[model samples]
Target: MQQLLAPIYSFLQCETPDSWIEEAKKPEQLKGLLIDHCNCELKAAQTAMFLVRKYAIDKQSGQLLLDWAKPYENFVYIKNRDIGVFLSKGSKKNELSGELVARKDFAHSDDLIQKMVRLIKEEFHHFEQVLEIMHSRGIEYQNVRAGRYAKGMMKQVRTHEPATLIDKLIVGAFIEARSCERFAKLAPYLDDELKKFYISLLRSEARHYQDYLKLAQAISVTDIGDRVAHFAAVEAQLICSTDQDFKFHSGAPVLNVTA
Candidate 1:
C-alpha cells in the first residue's frame, strides 16, 4: 500500500482531513459513503466517455460509445434502479470492439480513444462492484448532489481547443490521485471485504492518474507544470476546507454528529 500511495502522496499538496475521516468512519455514514462512491465511479466513467466522444472519436464511433454506456445510463437517469437487473445485463465489452474513427485535427486522437475507453471500462466495472457490495448489505443507491471538489478544479479549465483538453486531463489526474489516496487512508478503518476491495482499486486508480498525466503532457505543446500546480492547489483547498455535506470526496466534516 505504501508503494501504491508513494506517488499519490507526492502528487497532492495536502492530505484528507482527520475530521473528515473521523466523520466517515461512523457506522451510520457507511451507506452514504458507499452510495456516493458508487455515484463517483459512474461519474468518472461518464467523464471519460465525454472526453473520447468530444475530442477523439467521430460521430459514428461516439454514438457507439454512448450505446456502450446505455444500460448504466439507464440505471442512473431513467430510474431503472434495479440492482439485480443492472448487474445481470453485465458489461458490453464485445459491443465496444470496433474501429473508432479518430478526429482529423487531433494528433493523438487514437491514444486518447484507447486510454479513455480502457478507463471507462475499468470505472464501470468498479461501479458494478460497489453496487454489488451495496446490494449485499441492502443499501439502496440514490443520486446525490456533487460536492465542490470536482467543480472547484473544473472552474480553472482553459477555454481553448487542446488547452482545454489538456487542462481537463490534468484535472482528471488530480481527481484519480485523490481518490487513490483517500481509498488508502480509509481502508484501515473499513471492514475486511471493503478493505480488500479498496486496496484492490489502488493499482488501477494509480495507473489511471499516471495515464492522464502522460496524455496531458504529451498533448500540450507548452509546459503543464504551472497548470498542474495551480489545479493541485485548488484540489488541496477543496480537500482541506470545511464542508457541510458529507460525501466520499467532500472536504472536512462540519456536522457535529458522532458515531
Candidate 2:
C-alpha cells in the first residue's frame, strides 16, 4: 500500500487531517460516506465526459460521450427510482455506440479522449459497485448536496485558453489523488469487504491522477510545475481547513451527525 501511496503522499501538500478520518470511520458515517462516494464516482465520470466534450472531441463524438451517461443520469434524476432495478439493468448503457474521433485542430485531443473515456468507464463501474455495496448494507441511496472541496479548487481555474484547460486537468488530478490517499488512510478502519474494496481502488485512482497530469503536460507548451504547485497549495488548504460539511472529500468535521 505504501508503494501505491508514496507518490500520492508526496503530491499533496498534506495528508487528510486525522480528524476527518476519525469522523469518516464511524459506523454511522458509513452510510453517508458510501452515498457521497457513489455520487463522487458519478461526478468524476461526468467531469471526464465534460472535458472530452469541451476540449478534445468533435460535436458528434461529444454526443457519443453524453449518450453513454444518459442511463446513469436517468437512474439518478428520475423520482423514486429503485436501486435494485438500476443494479439489475447491469450497465447496458455503458458501452459506447462507437469509438470517438478526435478533432484535428488539437494536438493532444486523441490522448485526452482516450484517457478520459477509460476513466469514465471505470468511474461508472465504481458507481455501480458502491450502489451494490449500499444495497448489501441496507443503505438506501439518496441525493446529498455536494461539499465545497471540488468547488474550492474549481473556482481557481484560469480564464484563458489552454491555461483554463490545463488548470481544470490539474484540479482533476488533485481530486483523484486525494480520493486515492483518503481511501488508503481509511481502509484499515473499515470492514473486510469495504477495506478490500477501497484497497482495490488505489491502483486505478492513482493512475487516474497520473493520467490527468500527463494530459496536462502533453497539452501544455511550458512547465506545469507552477500550476500544479498552485493547486497543491489550494487543495491542501481545502483539505486542512475546517469544513462544516462531512463528505467523501470534506475537510475536518465541525459537528458530525451522520454527515
TM-score winner: 2
The CA lDDT at 107 in model 1 is 93
TM-scores of the models, in the order given: 0.96, 0.97
lDDT of 2 by residue, 31-66 (tens): 999999999999999999999998888998888888
Question: What TM-score does model 2 achieve against the real structure?
Answer: 0.97
Worst 10 residues of 1 by lDDT: 89-98
Supply candidate 2's per-residue lDDT for 83: 91
Residue 102 CA displacement from its true place in model 2, Å: 0.9
Over 1-259, each residue of candidate 1 has an lDDT whose tens digit, in order, gives 7987899999999999999889888899999999999999999999999999998878999888888888788888765478877778756632575678999888999899889988998998999999999999998889988788887888999998889999999999999999999999999999999999999999999999999999999998889999999998899899999988888889998866689
How does residue 92 of candidate 2 score in lDDT? 81
**Candidate 2: deviation at residue 141, Å?**
1.4
Number of the top-ranking candidate, with lDDT as the measure:
2
The positional error of residue 174 in candidate 1, measured at the CA in angstroms, is: 0.5
